[model samples]
Target: MGRRILLTCGEPAGVGPELAVKALGCGVDFAWIGDPRHLPAGTPVAQITAPDAQVPPGHLPVIRHDFAADATPGQPNPVNAQGVIDVIARAVDLVGRGDFAAMTTAPINKQALKEGAGFAFPGHTEFLAHLAGNVAVAMMLASTNVSPACRVVPATIHIPLEQVPAALSDEVLEQAIRITHAALIRDFGVAAPRIAVAGLNPHAGEGGTMGRQEADRMRPLLDRLRAQGLDITGPLPADTMFHAPARAGWDAAVCAYHDQALIPIKTLDFAGGVNVTLGLPFVRTSPDHGTALDIAGQGRADPESTIAALRMARDMAALRA
Candidate 1:
């Protein structure tokens, strides 16, 4: 419990700053990595030089990394994009050095990053992988202590629907599954995780009528994993896999594509959902939603997901410890 958690204030122009301030009283002891000037004028903040620095009640502890320019909520400035990226990298370094227990990120603007810094990665998941020396990683969306509580991982993410068929292969799916399986055990404290995997096509390819990927590729791989003593069930119809009864049977669901995995969690626990990175050397989590640009300064952006991410990171770290 003494180990510090770090939260990187994401895009300054978005709701990241507002949410970070709102998360101050959530009871998770964390230090912010961003410019203090970016916080709301009346927000209470205590500057810190170390990760474990303590702060008063109603005050947010901050590890300031001053941005190049003032941030205007609802209007993104590319000038500060490099600062946003720097905060993330610095937090990664600190976490890597064991200075922090876990790190939960705010939402970052990809377009602004690309325009300002020539950022090459698709998103945070990939960038973190690169920073950690190219380790295999999978994104898991989780919601706990609720009806239909579940964890989900997408085999193929951030790609066009047309490209999903070509992008997905046995290797990628296997890694996603294996990482998810191990994470359920280590991070979530599940002794015997039951994994229910979804099929790519309608009705699980309808026995090879809608698509042959399930029968030709997915089934064989799942069987191979089952034979290896993994409790896996799948190539099941995506439509039936997320209902209350079906969800009750598994600890996690590995879906064939992005939307297949995200929709259910977002639908059930939109504001409390957490995005967890599996297979990292340290725990990392983020709000399931993105930075709300329009409501940046209006105080309308809900901090529930961010709070949930922080809590989840703390719990995962505790499990690991």
Candidate 2:
């Protein structure tokens, strides 16, 4: 018996509920947090009255948070937006109190939340940071099954491409790298983690030919981290860093922006990738993809990523414990 983890069934209008139901069949030990009524009529679910409630085979253990209105598959209602937000807040509060080992969230529909609940933050990553006392958090996507299983952190996330140049700095890069390094050692159980950083420019700025960020910002930061006895590499060329031979050289790669990190992971293991939020007081993970509204109620949603998230959360929790 492992620790009971709390799971959030993200956007009801999307595939989150279906994927959650599907995840139960995958043998991950956890309880789902959402409304029982929202689950498709035929799904086997048991209401969880206690943290350690028994869940029968083929049945999902659920802690119900009744939504304002019933969710219609493939049709997001702003009326249920507040309820969606509340479920996440509940999971965070529970994890913070040690009521659960860790939390693995499903994909949320940000626009629906904003339209329905007046949600303030950009997305789950920022909202989670706000709830966790405004801590600095870095997003890392990881996969263990892929060859050269890689973990990546994007230095500048969710910012406009034009603004990336100004958004990326010595301070920002240092923060992302430091948080990632510590998380690898603590949560991932890597004794001496090797981190490779990607440059913002092509061919790692080719000695100032493509960009100066490598020479001016990243190089100095890497030097500082090296002096601190951290096994850090790069300002490497992003193009060459993700291949098998290159990936074998590092435990994780910190990239200059979002796509630089995500493209490779998604390409390698889109269905199994887990999005981990590093530097949080508690462990938090989510499916690496978003709500697939097109296939919302068709039972076509693949729960592989969610299952991977739950398994990853469990592994990370055990390491931390």
Q: What does candidate 1's lDDT look like per residue over 1-321, in tens digits?
A: 348789999999999998998887788888888998888889998998877876787888898899999999988898999999999999999888888999999999999999998889999999999999999999999985467687899989988999999888999999999999999999999999899989999999999999999999999999999999999998899988887899989999999899999998888888889999999998999999887897889989898999999999999999998
Clashing pairs in 2: none
**TM-score between candidate 1 and the true structure:** 0.98
Per-residue alpha-carbon lDDT of candidate 2 for residues 81-179, written as tens digits (9 for 90 to 100): 999899999999988888788999988899999998899988899999999999999999998678788899998899888999999988899999999
- Provide the TM-score for each candidate, comma-separated: 0.98, 0.98
Clash tally for model 1: 0
Best by lDDT: 1
Listed per candidate, the RMSD to the true structure in angstroms reads: 1.1, 1.3
Worst 10-residue lDDT window, candidate 2: 1-10
RMSD of 2: 1.3
Question: Which whole-number lDDT from 0 to 100 does residue 229 have in model 2?
Answer: 96
